[model samples]
Target: MFLGTGGMTPGHQLAERDDRKTAWAWYRGRAVRDLANGYTMKRVYR
Candidate 1:
């Protein structure tokens, strides 16, 4: 979650364009892999 948020945070914009692309790609890939492995979150409303 933090990786996804960090990828889009304002501070990310300060990075070089190439670095931003690489970071975003890495973050996205990690998310996809996790989902493929069945990692999930369930929300509980109380």
Candidate 2:
């Protein structure tokens, strides 16, 4: 799996093989992550 760097024009690419790939981006006052199912992971535990 591959990850992306966040910026004004961040880019990403990924290939999965039974892996939980995720990507995060800042929006409003929340930290959200992307999943393979096209769902935003809005839960932060850190």
Best by lDDT: 1
Model 2 Cα lDDT, one tens digit per residue, 9-42? 2233223321223322234215322352234334
In model 1, state the lDDT of residue 28.
100
User: Once model 1 is optimally superposed onto the true structure by TM-score, how far is the C-alpha of residue 5 displaced, in angstroms?
Assistant: 32
Candidate 2 structure, TM-score to reference:
0.12
State the weakest 10-residue window (summed lDDT) of model 2: 16-25
Tens digit per residue, CA lDDT, model 1, 1-46:
1256755766555566668789999999999988866644423322
For all candidates, the clash counts are 0, 0
Q: Residue 3 in candidate 1 has what lDDT?
A: 50
Stretches of candidate 2 off by over 4 Å are: 1-22, 26-46
lDDT of 2 at 18: 17
**Alpha-carbon lDDT, every model:** 0.68, 0.32
Q: What value of lDDT does candidate 1 attain over all alpha carbons?
A: 0.68
